[model samples]
Target: MSRTRFKVILYLDETEFSRAAAIYSAILMMNMPNMHLTIVRLKESNQSLLEIDEKCQNIWPTTSDVPQNALDVFLARSKDVQQQVLYSNPNIPDAVTALLAYVNKWAIDLIVMGAGEFSKIKEVIFGSLAYSLQNRSPIPVLLVKELSQDFLEGCNLTPTLTIVPKNQHGN
Candidate 1:
């Protein structure tokens, strides 16, 4: 069978460390030969996008704070392909809206995101981003606990092997 193209959007924060980790995890978990990855850093202002995208060649930056523009660009660029948006921060409403817009506009097939790191008390009191996404996202969303070095290294393997345990029946 022919390989299908995949366009993945990774929403990153200010720190490059987390972004790097997320990117590495995405490369491993997605494991599509025709995968195109774009890293978008959400900041307080518009300038951060240029700084991150330009200064850091690896990450694709965007200055559009409004959700529609971000989704439009993603959809227009990744036509006739599987599209996904992965965000580390679940509380950011802008990010949520952007992801939703992408799904609506492009009919995105999957969304992969890292689990939020909020306390149960805080989540119960104020609600959690992960919870919101899980409850509201239109398509399938795979929430990863943490991205490890081994997983990143495994991504480089020619034929990646992901073992999923079978049920007791062991079909």
Candidate 2:
């Protein structure tokens, strides 16, 4: 018998929310046996070496803050997952474009990303990637918020996850 697999991409950035998103993705991957996860981090060309190093340190181990037992399981499941870094300009449009290009190239089935805190003014000046992907992506996108320990302990996921479909607005 053949098994169906899902190709999922986890988008990363330098934010606490992004780290939370990574952890959430790890947990989801643990539960979803048919999922093939890929983590993609976008680094702008203008970022200093130190900044890149910091981000690399945090994301490579997606399970850094997870409990030891859960970390072990997450690590084992992540063996088949891939980590990739894409370099581009430090602009939302450019970053989104790079990710979209990769999504197209990889034929990804879903995109998992964090909804970082961006002010309305900043979002107006520079469009939000989450918003852009919501309107642009052809496949499903999962946006994860920074989850609290209490929430995870209760195993409540609905409050933390937002599923965005192509050209649709998600709350």
Q: Which candidate leads the pack in TM-score? A: 2
> By TM-score, how accurate is candidate 1?
0.49
For model 2, which pairs clash? none
- Which residue pairs clash within candidate 1? none
lDDT of 1 at 24: 44
Cα RMSD for candidates in order = 11.8, 10.2
lDDT tens digits, residues 94-142, model 2? 7777777778887899998888777889988878989788678888888
**How accurate locally is residue 107 in candidate 1, as Cα lDDT from 0 to 100?**
53
- Angstrom error of the Cα, residue 132, model 1: value is 1.5
Per-residue C-alpha lDDT of model 1 across residues 69-125, encoded as one tens digit per residue: 333333434322222224323345645665566556645556555565678798778
Worst 10 residues of 2 by lDDT: 48-57
Candidate 1, residue 61: CA error in Å?
A: 6.3
Deviating ranges (above 4 Å) for candidate 1: 1-3, 15-21, 24-26, 43-95, 149-171
lDDT of 1 at 26: 42
